[model samples]
Target: MIRDLLHNKKRLSLPKGTGILFAMMFLMAPVQIVAQDTPRVTSKIDSTHIRIGEQVQFEISVEADTTTLVVFPEGQTFAPLEMVRASDIDTFRNKDRMNLIRTYALTQFDSGHYTLPRQKIIVNNKELYTDSLQVLVNDIAVDTTTQKMYDIKPLAEVSRNYSDWVRYLIWGIVFLAVAGALIYWFFLRKKPLTQEEKEALLPPFDRALLGLKQLEESRYLIQSQYKEYYSELTNIVRAYLEEEVHISAMESTTEELVAKLEMMQQAGKLNLEKDTITNFKSVLQKADLVKFARSRPDTHGAEEDRKVIENVVVRTKEAIPEPTEEELLQREEYIAEMARKKRKKKRITTIIIAAAVLVVALGGAVTYYGFTKVKDTVFGHPTRELLHGEWVNSEYGYPAIVLETPQVLKRTAIELPESLKQVISTNQTFTYGGLLGDFHISASVTTFREGVEFNMEDAIQGSVKTMEQQGAKNIIVKQDEFTTPSGKKGIKVHGSMDITLPGTEKSEKGEYIILNFNEKGAFQQVIIIHRQDDRYAKDIENRIVNSIDFKNQ
Candidate 1:
């Protein structure tokens, strides 16, 4: 030992404080070695014997002490054989030398001489083994003639007692209340038309008066409660719109209510003419700023606004057209027809929906006794007949297919030649921002022959009309034709184009060219014109054209 110690000086001569560490390490060395070597496994049986169709548990475990630990079962056969579960589990060491085992349980229901192999458990630098257990299974035989199972019958639904008077009494109470309301409305219409009624019928100015009086009483203006001022102004406007146009203005947003009013005006139903609504919208928007924006109106602006409101009230009174005989008759007829149709439709729709419900309910009636036919439709036919795979390829437009197959490579790209520079429409730059760009020109145009082969000439019709309506600057197009440098069989396309390049800088639209197609139209083309600069408009057009493909695929 002295000679060995002299040979290996670092072995026993531990430094200061190292003695205690050495003792502890010595005490734990065997445990650490065992932990490093011996792996753990688990085994259990849910039951010894299960019926023929029943399953039995066969579990094996392996400690995950190594980076690549695995277990394999050998030799032992399966019984009651049906694999139900195979799971991996983990474990930890307890205060004592006991190991909390992780486990995997496998089960089967098939019967016969199935044996499980010995399980091999692998841990760090070691392998462990578990002995396999045997299982026996037997099935019980039954005589068809002597054995039978009785099925329980379902409980019948409890019948509702139509003979009960309580339901009738409740219905009677509802009918009576409704009848009372009808009587009140009928009588109320007759005994009205007093000062209140006269005021209600007045030009809606009285409400403004009342609001002004309320404002005066509350002294809100003196208190500089601008929020209240704007709120009242908005309310007054909403009330006015509701009364004038019969719209639910009070409950709507400024945009929603204004949109409705404008729609009514466009339909020629509202009496207010052009500039009237423009002013109305401005006033409302201003009031909104004061209310929600927490802004206070100066005395002049406030007074001017109040006067404007009064002026609007007066102008609206003037704007309210004196009903011509023809107009009055038309309005009355429209109202009467709408009311009559509404009543008739409600009654008929209610009856139709109720009848449809009854028909659906009758589908479950005993008259549906063709269970064998239904079964054949659902399962028998499919089982008896041959089946082909289902194909769903109706709208297989380029939408589903990708331009490129592999992730690394990109799809085809192009930039249009400067010679093709032109604008289709002179106006609505908002709608056509692609006309201005400076970049190399390379283009690839593929017509999606599979989809509706849109005629390029016809496609411009819609755009032309829209721009015309917007009064966008117009440019003349000189017709030109180009035989596509490439095409597919059947019809070779001799395409034509009409260019409308912008004439002035103010008319910055430089590309309004329409590509007219002949008999042969294929995949949508990539018409990437060289952009003057990197622009979104040109990029969009290029993408749209390239996205279409009409290969035989």
Candidate 2:
């Protein structure tokens, strides 16, 4: 009787709802038939068990017709086990069907037994589900009771490494090379002149005579420009004395020039006649009177004076003794040396100006973006992403230290002293972190009673003491005048300290600041503490300090 009832299922579905259910099942039969007909997917793992946090490989393979499109799972679709890495799909063809294989690196942090749920894979507008898998993540077993423990190794003494010395040596050699090249080019390098050089370096008497001829051609004496005439006359003679006779005649008065000539004559350097010296003195004195005293000379007198000046030049040349071989050689060497020095001086001036421009450009970049950024642009820094991340603008404390920061500052309760309570009628504090944290920020505002005198130095010292109580050791404090954005004068105190976190044995380097502002009876204070070497925190400290503004201002 039971077998007959089971075989009569078609007769049992005569109801209207049951007939609709059969029609719907018939319509979905093709999808089920397609999935059952082909072995499209298979999921497998290398091992069913693994040590916690150890990686395991999970593979999924598919075999399909050549014209099918397949898409694998991506992202955090696997919840119990994290996907460490996912491999690309590998495809191969065998006869009519295409085979594809994909691998995933998976790990689990916790020690537990987990099930990887069936994953959906799409192939040619059809959904195919993979088989469920089981993985057991077990903790590493250790027998501490039977194992012996060893003390930590002490710090080893280390000498300077060869690479460090080599780097320094390379830099030193480069510096010396640049300095030596500059010195040689500027001071010691010798450049000999060609035959044309001798022609260019005319003797003082020849130069002066040529100048006088040019002056005559100018015809200033005929034009009644006595001042111009006298000025040229004096310059020609003075230049001749400076170049040939080794006298600073251009920088001397008329009397001093004459005295120098007499001294040279007495020293046997020259054989100047008494009349020649007298004629030279008279021409110079008359020229000075015309140029400086505005005295005019008649044309005939000027013409006679010009002739006398020419004679004086001729006489002085005759008075100069013949140069010895040694003297001639020395003179040639001196001239060559002077020419070289002039060329080198010009080159050095250009180099200095270029170097200054480069330095100014580099300094401006560093000042705006900081040394870390500048270095990153050259060598690279690790914290560029964090330093330049999005920042938030917010207000904190009662009097309100309004500023922008990378993260919002949290409020903290601070205990007040009895004496402080009497002077500070109302105060509030908002903070974010502690001394040893990567970034710390705090702001405090206090309103004082009438006729209250707030000592800034005392308050700063007290703050340092408070930091010491809070586990800051080896504290070093420094103070400087601070001005707010609104131009109110204030005090800024900054320092470094060694901080030991509450649950850690190691000490960390820290930097901190205390900025105090007093306007009338209202006092605003801000404090910052952070890791010393964290560039992002230091940037935040500077940004906060510079952004402070007072309502009264």
Candidate 3:
């Protein structure tokens, strides 16, 4: 090949060292057969240019299977191009064997030539760059022949206000001076002390302030999270209680602690104050009502509870007076008395159990029980002129207050909240039982159909026969003067009830009585299905119930 080229008289010239170095390079270099590489696109521009304030689309495309999808960095964002949309992607394959392609579209408004820099694509496990692609466009062409642009609005009037910077500087200087004085007073004038002394300097009052400061950070109360707010408030007070009262309130239920404190007060032994404990108990009760029963207090109630907690905290911190010398001796005697009372209770309990055991040993006979015993679940007879509170019940569930014909709510003489009363003044007739008392005072207005009178005797008699006739699984009586569903205490009067009239269809049982007051006396009949407890439930029926005088009023 060299001889054939020399015959043609073609000669190449190189500097003396250059030729030797070139030869060396050619000899030492590795030979590579490079295929024409696919275009490595870094970005895709939808349009090269756009009029100012008018948008253009741009897209960035990469031509490799292995390449990072690029996004404009914080400082490198395109001012000319505003992004209308963005897409996220990772691995992609190309249909063409020569190139793998991916792109991001970008738009620019201001007309100019924008060049996307050399793009990187991974090939043969190495990044190779392709020459940048330049996009070219011209600014919007304006016709001078047409009327000159007429709508060029003038600039906004400049604001020529006086500078307040000097006033701000003076104010800042004053603030800095005051701050410096405060710092000096706080640090240099601060008492040098041991750790204990420093803590002591943070007196109880200052500690309380600190606690209040921390509490201010928690906005639970303002946010109406009363449960959490009360919980934290109570915790703080409970810690204080342990500090002041020498009792671990955290370990005790309110009921248990209150009872213990009450006993101390009644005996006049230890000085257990009331105002503080009462306030404490009130808050706890309100909290318990909210937490356990989901009973939300009204705004006033919540405020009152908060006030009570505050009072408890303040009052509890005051030191109690210790016993004088004479009082100490008196307390010793009082302790002896308490011991004697405990012994007495134990002895009484023992005597009763022993007597009962002895009677059982003698084989003493007892009479049959059910007919005479007061039924836990059922109401027996009806009466007129209830002397006090009465109870009403139904078979379905606990006895709620029964009123007659709840349908005509507007015409009712007695005002009652919906929960405690139901109307049962039925069109159907009721059998009568004799009245146990002289007068029947019914706030229950009879909305009976024309033929029906409020017949006490017939209604009671029919009720008994109905029960015997109907094979009822159970029946409940509505009672007043028992605890209510929401734990409010009040008297509730019933209108009518459902009776399983044996063998007959279920009838509206209405043998209700009116006491001079409500049924707190003998006429407070019960349903066989004893269900509800109304206000003051523990009050038992007795012979004295008959003495409750009846007035026609």
**How do the residues 41-146 of candidate 2 rate in per-residue lDDT, one tens digit apiece?**
9889898899988988889999888777888888867767888999998998987788899998989877879888788888877888888899899998888899
TM-score of 2: 0.36
Compared with the true structure, what per-residue lDDT tens digits does model 3 show for residues 107-210?
54446676655544555555666555565546768897885767767535544332344554786678557655654555435466897576555745445444
**Model 1's TM-score against the true structure:** 0.23
Poorly placed runs, candidate 2 (over 4 Å) = 1-203, 251-268, 273-275, 292-295, 325-355, 375-506, 509-553
Which segments of model 1 are wrong by more than 4 Å?
A: 1-218, 270-275, 324-553
Winner on TM-score between 1 and 2 is 2
RMSD (Cα, Å) of candidate 2?
Answer: 18.4
**TM-score, candidate number 3:** 0.21
Which of 2 and 3 is the better model by TM-score?
A: 2
**Candidate 1 lDDT for residue 504:** 43
In what order do the candidates fall by lDDT, top score first? 2, 1, 3
Model 2 / residue 475 / CA error / Å: 24
Clashes of 1: 53
Q: Candidate 3: where is the Cα deviation over 4 Å?
A: 1-217, 266-275, 298-300, 322-553
